[model samples]
Target: MGMTLVRSLFLIIHQKMSTSSSAILTPVGVRGMNVLDRAKFLRNIKIPVLKVADEKLSKITPICKQYFLKLENFKPVQSVSGEKLKCIHMNPEKIGAWTDLSEIDRKSLKEHSVNEDNFIMKDIELSYENWSYGTIFKAVLPENEDIVSGFTQVGHIIHLNLKDHLLQYRPLIGQVLVNKIKSCRTVVNKSSTIDNTYRNFNMEVIAGEENFLVTVKENLCNFTFDFSKVYWNSRLGQEHERILNFLKPGDVLFDVFCGVGPFAIPAVKKKCKVYANDLNPDSFKWLNHNAKTNKLNMALFKSYNLDGKDFILTVFKEYITNYCLGKEKLEKGAKIHVTMNLPAIAVEFLKCYKGLIEDEELLEKFDCEIIVYVYCFAAGTDVLAVAKSMVIDNIGCDISDNIIDIFDVRNVSPKKEMIRVGFKLGKEVIFSAKDCVSEPPKKKLCVDN
Candidate 1:
């Protein structure tokens, strides 16, 4: 029998029980009654089952027992002739069960006659078992499996990049994610791509609270930032830790585009002096807040809000001059490291390093080498070669193959990749005016903006 027809019959029986006063509810497979006899008895007798509201079930249990009706367990079934048989019990009533009726009962019920009004037809509410987000969404929207796979959770926020076709169902998908995911309290959809220098994408809240403040723990450090304003990629936890493992206690780190101090603050906690800066004022504000929250000494860390080029030329240059030159030369175990993480344009910022220390005498006297870790996006199969060439062109010097170390970070797209090119800045690249001078390239590489 079709499930729709069976459910319709179950509702009919439920309605009759609710309205009728004398309802003799009986199970289909009684001990003494055979399949044919049970079918005959059900067809001939007008058995009215009592339907008590779910909340009032406790009060009506005694009344169900007084009538000697089967009030223990109710299992709705189909007759041998493909007719749906309704069963009712008083202990705890459930409308339907998925079971097949015997062939004899199906035929007998078809031959027997019963009032149509006794079988009340109402809407059937299907119950669902709590399952995973993908499973539940698949059950509800089997056609849009990709939508379920596109969501990313950052802290307590569920971030989704829904396709244009799935925009109509954004609310439905977002609500389901919020309901299904225990850690998520708010859900937002990516409304626009990251096109600005701040590296922040436009987002619209589709479900739950409107708040975007979140606290994320990484590398044993707690970081709090406004998700809507600043840029934070929880996916980069491994990258953050990988870089941290390379640092020593006395290393000086200059983060050119330090969004909320993800790299800087952690370095500070490791007893490294950090000079962190960002173009976004919001990022700068939170960077200071996070530094203080982490209980880092103000003397060990300095935060700045300035353009990438200006920051390198000003704040970073000052650090090199003061701590890396003259009387305040770095100790034996100390080192200088610059982090340019704006993968899209960070390679171009390498130009600032040229003519960074203009004085030949000071450049020659500078015994410590400045290592730069420039993150950039490279296309094609030979990602390391592309990244190396880009770094060499921007720095205006031929970096030796032995010193340049390029690490493949991650694939940003099918044909594009994010790679980190690390090399030490020598006197020729920093002090020699001829080697430092170079014009911008005619064509630019494709990278995230």
Candidate 2:
């Protein structure tokens, strides 16, 4: 039986009595267990032998609970700075609406109408201000000459104007509509950088060629980020402060696809022990640079290509062996948090590690957390299947029930597509689930052995 073999191996190999060996009979999960005859024996075993689903099964039911919880906490908070979104104004006559004409005039126009109906959808050039007039019968401009275009499609609410020109020609109708627009609301926080009326969470963004200095006016928490020569995109800034709320003290954070230390620097700033890495040399340079800039202790950065299985195995062995050979034995094992920003590629490394590594005794050596960003391309050709293939090649054949939590699927583009799934490792020892894009799509359906 698989359980019998695992127990025997653990008893024979495990000698050191550190934090991992507190007592006897710790529940363990055996993934990809092919011994069907021994499955019953393994199940009946006193220890908790958790069974993980294969890649094929996981795809069929990809809605892992851990993936959802992380997203619930990661979404951007409402705009804190009371900065209003931009709007525009347009002339009333150019808007094209029909009104103010008498019944006689209307009858005359109806006689000459193309549809031979007394009523017509006309663009009478109404101003934005006219929208506030309840009794006023007005005609709005159609979309691209399409008469069916509704009021919402005609133009933005800001484009309305007043038609009267006898006096100073002020837009009375437009002014009314402008008042209807709600004033911008700001989320209050000390770390905000905004000043005076805009004093909510204002960040002074100092963009550089390879790095940027972000200083918060309120909290005085300044962070210099290295972007591997790539400026951090505006979207990241939008979500940074919000995501930073989840960091806790003393947590070991690992940013696997760490690009210029966006997650790592903030994590270290929160006093978390960080192990950040990136395949790109430029990225690692910035990662280390940012780590030094923040003066984060216990933060380690490694540069390696995560696409290959052998490279991953070597890295894990080195980190584990190094930890084991350290001055003190791992107290309760290293509390590691492996962050994978690359969704399409992280799974491969996870699968490889799951297949190659199985050290129940060394469970105290490391703990991992994975962040997977699943980006769906077009929707036409069975995107789920493609996603399934991608998931299998990336995450490996089987996974453990050690799912901490997963974030909600985020839309990366206009189309309701592309999602990011973050996986936190739970109570069991397992490799990272986040994956990279190394294995191309193949016709073969992944088989779980």
Task: List clash counts for every candidate, in order.
Answer: 10, 44
CA shift of 64, model 1, Å: 37
Q: In model 1, what are the clashing residue pairs, if there are any? A: 12-119, 12-120, 17-49, 23-48, 79-106, 80-105, 80-106, 80-107, 81-106, 81-107
lDDT of 2 by residue, 348-438 (tens): 4555444234555545654443333333232334445445455545555433243333333343334333333334433232423334434
Q: What is the lDDT of candidate 1?
A: 0.63
- In TM-score terms, candidate 1 sits at 0.69
lDDT score of residue 131 within candidate 2 = 30
Each candidate: what lDDT?
0.63, 0.34
Candidate 1's displacement at residue 89, Å, is: 22
Could you give candidate 1's per-residue lDDT for residues 9-92 as a string of tens digits? 223221211112222232222222211121322212233343333444344334234332231122322122343333332121
